[model samples]
Target: MSKFDSLYIAAKEKLLAAKNIAMVTHINPDGDCTGAALAVRKLLLALGKDADIYNEQGFPSFMEFLRGDAVFNRYTQEDGVEYDLTVFIDCGNIDRAGKVAWVCEKSDFIINIDHHSTNPMFGDINIVDSTASASGLLIYDFFKACGVEITLEVANFLYVAIMMDTGNFSYSNTDKRTHDVAGDLLELGVDPSVLTQKILRSTTYNKLKLTAMAIDTLHMYCDGKIAVIHASKAMYNATGTDSSDSEGFVGMIRDIKDVGFAVFLRDTTDGKLVKVSIRSNLDVDVSKIAAEYNGGGHYSAAGCSIEGKIPDVEEIIVKRLSEEL
Candidate 1:
């Protein structure tokens, strides 16, 4: 049996006892978080139970095509509801649920599902496997434990989760088992060509314009080992864009040849803080740097936020990366 088998069994027991379930993910829901939540909902629905998916901030536009879009609600969209069980997926800590974390307090049990090494295990039952490629993969296991077949919808959602988190299987985390899982997903008829076109290729005009602006702001330091990109509020306003449009902007900087680490800073919508994304080629553990700013993620990719101007956050992060490099 796997090391997490016991945790999965415990989680299954809690889920079986609960008739009404509420699910949540981290604050800026990514494909892995979004997919895992939806897949879990699908599992619960198949079991003849009610599942409500919640997010403080709804998913990105590319994810709208996933199943259960109608049932996915923001905290404000609900009319003060409660649940027998609250399941938090792809979140490192309970606080990662943002405002909705308080709503979960009403639940009789909480299950934390994640694949981050920094996960705090803040739940009545925690199923955390830092070695797993994505939380959606863990949900895939959950489906197996429940003896549910992997439907096309479930496969599609898990495909998006695994693909995005693995950078389409190009990241370091893509191992033999990861590919094995992908192979199984392919058998369920998830077309990689169509998914890539819909996700990575289908960029909006405004997003492209924002990307151009972000590229112009790139700064290389530490003899070109550390690269930085900053997006100001004015840039977003001028380009008719928002934080969503800035997604994947950090990858462009990380792609710079000879750059060991890359950092992207964007002014938060409320303008009170700067959101920082870090990507590393090798040698540096960006997650550690992110943890210093109350953020955490994988070794090669991580994110955090800082209270200050974008320039200030950029300066501090660049300096830190410089010291590490």
Candidate 2:
């Protein structure tokens, strides 16, 4: 049995027992969080119940198709909604839900499903396994365990969630079981190339322009083992793009030759803060570095936010990376 087998049964039972159900995505909804939440909503509907998906922001621009005309189905935290059971998908902690964290108070039961190692086990019924590549795999297991049919929509949703989080299955987290779930999704009509074209290939002009400007800021340390790239507020204003446009900046630079660790620092929209994303291609755990800054993630990928000027924060992170490397 899987580590989450018992939790799955309990979650399934609670889901059936509850009438008012709300599915919540984390703040800064990525493909994994958004897709898994939406997939669960579809799963709940297939099980003879309806659910509403809420996020701090509705959805990222890249996955707007998933939120098409979701009028009533998609909601924000400002809605001040209450539910008997609230599901937090792919969130490491309640705070990751941003303002929507309050729903945990209004919710009698909270089901936390995630694959992040840093998760705090905040759920009344937690189905968390850091071993899994993505939360989509866990939700897929739940669907299989319940003997529910995985529809095309659910399959596609799972595909995006898994594919994106696994970096198109090229990241270290990809494993035999990851592919097993993906193969099952393919049987359910997931088109890999089409998804790749839509998600990976369809970068906006502003995003590419922003990337170019950020690339100009690239700096190397430790004999090129560590590379740092940044996007300042000025770059965003110049390119008419925000942080969302620069989603894969760190990973993109990590591919550069001789660069094992890549860091991307981007200034937040407001305040004197910089958001940091780190990715590693070596055996080093980048998440530990993020933890020192009060953030967390996986061994190979992680992030944190720092309160400082972007240049200062960049220097601090590069020095830290130098020490770690």
Candidate 3:
């Protein structure tokens, strides 16, 4: 029996009692959050309930393969409707829901599901396991508790959920159970190579151009213990790309030889906000650093956003991170 069995039962009870369900994802939805959201929709449907996913930022084009022909329902800051329940998937904080946070206030019940180490337990029934590599794993466990079979459709979404957050099973979070669940997905005929090609190998030329530009700002700090990069608004303008195009830039820095920590500062297109992404390959907990800025994530990868000039934000984050190193 898993330690989360009781929590799963409580979540199931709330979900079972609900009539209309609203599934919400965090800002800048990623595979883990999006995948978990989709699975919840499928589960609600399987149980003969109505479920709708509300993502304020919409889905990423790179993740289109996961959705296939399905179109995600977008939350456009409307408040006329009310839901019996709203489930937050992969969101560490209610604020992470961005514009759609209004749903939480209107919903009769709230269920927060996540795996972030900094989660504050914001849900009426918070199903959070900081030790779990991905929130998709929690959804997987919930399905088991409900006696729901791991269908192929659910498997595809869940697989990518684990794969993305775990960096394709190569990150430190991948463990025996992670692999065991991935193996089960493989048995369901999920072609990993095909998905990998669709995700990592299918980058556009503009994205590469943005990467080249971000790489140009690379600098070392803390005697090469910390590596940093930035995608300025000018760089995005020159590359014809936006903040979304800067994905995976921090990981590239973290992979640098002998670099223990990596930070990527992205100046939003409007130039009024700078989003900070951090990753670490050593004992440093980057999430703790991110928390100081009101961001939350796992130890290996975390992020926060500051509303200020890129130069100022960069200096602020670098100095804080330096203290940790």
Top of the candidates by TM-score = 3
- Per-model lDDT: 0.84, 0.85, 0.85
Give candidate 3 regions above 4 Å deviation: 68-70
The lDDT, on a scale of 0 to 1, for candidate 1 is 0.84
Q: Which stretches of candidate 2 lie over 4 Å from their true place?
A: 68-80
By TM-score: ranked, best first: 3, 1, 2
Q: Could you estimate the TM-score for every candidate? A: 0.95, 0.94, 0.95
Candidate 2 vs. true structure, TM-score: 0.94
* Candidate 1: tens digits of C-alpha lDDT, residues 1-325: 3577778778777787887788888887788998888888888778776677788877667788775544667765355666889899999877788877775777888898999888878888888898989887898888887778899889999999999899889989998878888899999999989888888789888888889889999888989998899888899899898777887788888888898998889995556799899999987677888999899988889988899887778888888888876
lDDT of 2 at 88: 89
TM-score of 3: 0.95
Location of the lowest summed lDDT over 10 successive residues in candidate 3:
68-77
Clashing residue pairs, backbone N/CA/C < 3 A, model 3: none
Clashes of each: 0, 0, 0
Angstrom error of the Cα, residue 299, model 3: value is 1.6
